[model samples]
Target: MRRTDVAEAWLGVGTAALMTALAPLAGATLAGNVGAQLLRDQQGWHRTTAVLTENAAYTETAVAAGDTGRAEAMVRWTAPDHSVRTAMALVPTGTRAGATTAVWTDAAGRLRHQPMTAHQAEVLGDLAGACAAAGVCLVLVGGRRVVVRVVLDRYRARAWERAWAEVEPRWTHRHA
Candidate 1:
């Protein structure tokens, strides 16, 4: 093989090694950042007791066998300002109107999802990070491949033209 081919092969090997090393580092960094951000977003969230109200979706009949444990229900709760607020929240299925359940609320007394547990945050962060890492790896390696291929193709084309030019005069008995 030509020296250029050897160099190209080495470049590919180096790129692969670099990407392999970076994927995990990128994943971990992104995961930590995302997880930390998620945790921070939950900082001001608080839990409150909310009374379930009427919901058309749930009927007096027994819950179906496939009940998912939680269902959307109208609920009212007192905010920190002593003002009453109402909204839909997820509560245990089969809960009747007037039943109370724990719900999360933001500072503005708006219904919000409960604070994510550390495990939940980590899991979500890991997922996001993994996706980001995969994307990074793909773009880097794929872009490298395309660039290298283009450069090599152009080089080979030029070399072929030069070789043909040198041979044509002698082969055809024609001089420029």
Candidate 2:
């Protein structure tokens, strides 16, 4: 073949090979993204359930306190099964008047003395209110508790939108 003809043939062959190789790569990437999305969805569902369970625990504590017509209090932990287990005792009415009360519990559920700050207590009270209003739970460990109401139904669509934005560019480049 002439030089120009041979060059054209080589270019066409390279284009065909690239296209063939890219097709399977695109398919594999799509499958991976789908699998990742499924896993994310499952995790989001589990988190939502956990939040709901925690909210219930907060409500229970509030109700128990309210029923006694005094400032009753209890501390609970979220179990692995998404259930709240009471970890501390209920302080009855007419106890000491303090801005913050700290009740520490050991791994064996034994009560230990803790000194909580007023700010921490106020934040917990706000979280409790938010949980009761939103029907979701909030658990604070060392700092202020802030509940943003990130329910699965409320944020799932946004999460999927974000996931798509992350995946789409890769997908377009692969296909192109």
Candidate 3:
């Protein structure tokens, strides 16, 4: 508990905490940027209302799970060009025929996933950043501990050599 040791300990703790906190912020920023890029790329996609042509079908297991069961149904929608298009699309389970839902389509009237939302980007960024930070902290802490152990071992070896040198002549009854 020397002053230097106390100071070093505090510094290590502060640095670790700072790294952990900073990683999430960086991650969030990165995620937001990526999300924005996705939004930009999603330009020219058309959003239109689609009508379900049949009852949405879902797997029995998925329905039994009580989740928003994955379901697909035939849907019909007019493209931006004013031409009617028909295709199979994912829909909420139990949606009956004639129900209308919003969908995104490319210029050729092909279905596409929507752009990344801000909230989704932030969450993804936070998770990725936190995991990365944790990995970095673990590696640094482990490396530090290993180095400290090696240094302490070297000190102990030197101390032992000196102590043995002082006692060797007396123990052997030979004055140097």
TM-score per prediction, in order, is: 0.81, 0.24, 0.53
lDDT of 3 at 12: 75
Stretches of candidate 1 off by over 4 Å are: 55-67, 168-176
Winning candidate number (lDDT):
1
Which stretches of candidate 3 lie above 4 Å from their native place?
Answer: 1-45, 48-55, 68-70, 74-88, 94-102, 105-111, 150-176
Q: Estimate, for each residue in 11-70, the C-alpha lDDT of model 1 and write its tens digit.
A: 788878978988889999999999999999888889899998865265333256455677
lDDT of 2 by residue, 103-175 (tens): 4443443444343444554555454444443321111211111112333324546767888888998988864
Candidate 2 ranges beyond 4 A from true positions: 46-176
> Candidate order by lDDT, highest to lowest?
1, 3, 2
Candidate 3 root-mean-square deviation in Å: 5.5
Residue 34 in model 3: lDDT: 62
Best-to-worst TM-score order? 1, 3, 2
For candidate 2, the per-residue lDDT at 66 reads: 64
